[model samples]
Target: MEERLQAVTTPVLLESSAAGFSPWGSILRAIPEAAGDVPALLALAVEAGETWPRPGEGRTSLLFELLASVAAIDVAAARVFEPHLDAIAILSQAARTDTADQPAAAGSAGGTSWGVFAAEAPGARLNARPEGAAAVLDGAKPWCSLAAGLDRAVVTAHTDDGGRAAFAVDLRHPGVRCEEPAWVARGLREIPSGTVHFDHVPALPLGGTGWYHSRPGFAWGGMGVAACWLGGAVGAARDFRAGLLAGADAGREPDQVALAALGEVDRILAAAMQYLARTATHIDDGSLAAAGQSTWSEAQRVRGTVAAAVERVLQLVLSNRGPGPLAFDERYAKRMADLGLYVRQHHGARDDAQLGRLTLKGDCPW
Candidate 1:
């Protein structure tokens, strides 16, 4: 299973890096029509579309599946964009295999940083002037997941030409820096969620800057992050179960607390699956606006539910199962942290604002 996933992932990464587009958008479109050589891809993607806790393992599985799905389609993004698949895989594995560093240099940390998908501000206003483009990058990007050890980032910057433009910059370039200004938290410490600074880093244009935002694929691409979060939730749930079983050997005893936690996890996961299927239908019908609306709404609801369930499961395990589950130096603590952190990626106060505006304005394109 792993080999098949790697086979699909390797080539697309190579091709994408050679070109310049993200392979995610293309992979999502090809998932349904792909050949039957791999069922793991679907299983992993579906699992991510739900919820759980294992950040490192969850990310590895989802990233592999995403790559396979894209390769199945043979999309131009994979064929042309410079591929970062190997880099991503390496980072994810490192995160899973190693312990979270004690909050060190901003971008040097490894782990969940690789397996995640992050985006810059798509709608921020930028100044357009031949002289202004070189002065500075004047905007804030709230969610850059793999800001550490990033080689390149596709950023949307306002140019001096009176319009927005997107540029892909090699992070190793002159002006780029990763800043860790404290005030970050979650159950998992592996995600190097920090700021990527481009103090006038030389930017290579990626199509027209404004065009990137208007593209249907660009908007649809945001949903891919939700898929990753869902995968984490599944891994966490599995760990939670193991912890439950290890705590006092409650085998087949129908422990009320464990049963309740399981029930909550199951319910949230089911809702997430149905929501994903509905969103997939929207994609099939070529109604991107509809898909975005559904995707956004479902993401908001599901993220909150999953986050709550993960917390509940942890409480149940810790309270009922006791601390023996932690004796083996396992990753339960980190998994919990990872899930909590990743879940907030979707269910933030910003989502509430968007959802509110969507409700207020009946003119949603969907």
Candidate 2:
């Protein structure tokens, strides 16, 4: 993960020494060892913000490659970095200049951690009511990941016209309070995603209703998350491959079943990677529309393809590797657990249904 990711993002990293040594090289290599340290992940996120450019701004491939690399090392660390970077891209897409309050992407004070909280649930809702020249958030917004540790967030809340709007709010404000982190999930344990309450928390509106999702960058952001899933699948498959090699190294003949599983994984990963690369080119060149494609439909295909590949790879690794790693190896078990949980962000059949609808509307390539 470190080697490939470093190579992919090398051109974009901020050089710190005459010998072209990058501070990010140290950070990228150190993140996996950091495990789930919140402070450490935040520090890495800050470094990533200052270093990485916004996706669809000419280096979208690097953005996806970097995300895959971080996720390959540690999903928990990527959990902290992904949303922080996405928030900056959102701010950039809105065409508003970031100020001292907003900061530049991720580098900021120790307390300036950021997360994106836009997941909605019935009854547990956050709303932005009109307040003269501004808006005040009220009610509960569920799944506000790391809200307790994060100082700021780009959150989507309901508006008065029954549409949703995005807002950037200071989580440190007195009116905001993170509910007790009741997160008991074994995967991504470092990131506590629960409810956060806002009692008249003043928020600066980011975009009007429909502006957030309708923008082209929204598809790019979704694809960025898919890259993380793709990376997690890659990491899982790599471990399985290593186990097969270990038996061969010990003078044991390679099992054909394991070899077959590895071959399938190779195909899955290769196709998914190609899809991401092609779509990223479309995004950078503004060719999706030129080629009679919608960015949303293209994003759906990449996400669906990568997510299906992840599920198949996971099944193959678990079936072929047996229970040894899950039972005895801490790193292997944690990686599988994290991958299993994190990939659920794909929304399964519901997303497939969306893509199916797009195809029916003739938005998909046959």
Identify the leading candidate in terms of lDDT: 2
Worst 10 residues of 1 by lDDT: 74-83
C-alpha lDDT of candidate 1 relative to the true structure: 0.43
What is candidate 1's CA lDDT for residue 317? 47
Task: State the lDDT of candidate 2 residue by residue for 47-165, as single tens digits.
Answer: 78777868899878777877777777777777888998998788778765352255533345642567889898887989899897679999999999988877788899899999999
Per-candidate total of colliding backbone pairs: 36, 0
Regions of candidate 1 where Cα sits further than 4 Å from its true position: 1-148, 161-164, 180-188, 207-209, 246-252, 287-329, 347-350, 363-366
Backbone-clash count (model 1): 36
| Predicted model with the maximum TM-score | 2
Instruction: Tell me each candidate's TM-score.
Output: 0.56, 0.91
Error of 2 at 292 (Å): 1.9
The runs of at least 3 residues in candidate 2 whose Cα sits more than 4 Å from the true structure, single-residue gaps closed, are: 1-24, 99-111
In the range 1-366, model 1's lDDT, one tens digit per residue, is 655343333322211242333434444444424322223233333233223212223232234335323422322222111123332222233332121222322333221122222354555333323333333454445455445444444556666666676554455655656667364564433334555655655544445546655544343344444444444445455556655555548565657767786777667655654554454445446453543454444444544444554455455545654566555535555444554554555545676677667656653434
- Provide the lDDT at 76 for model 2: 72
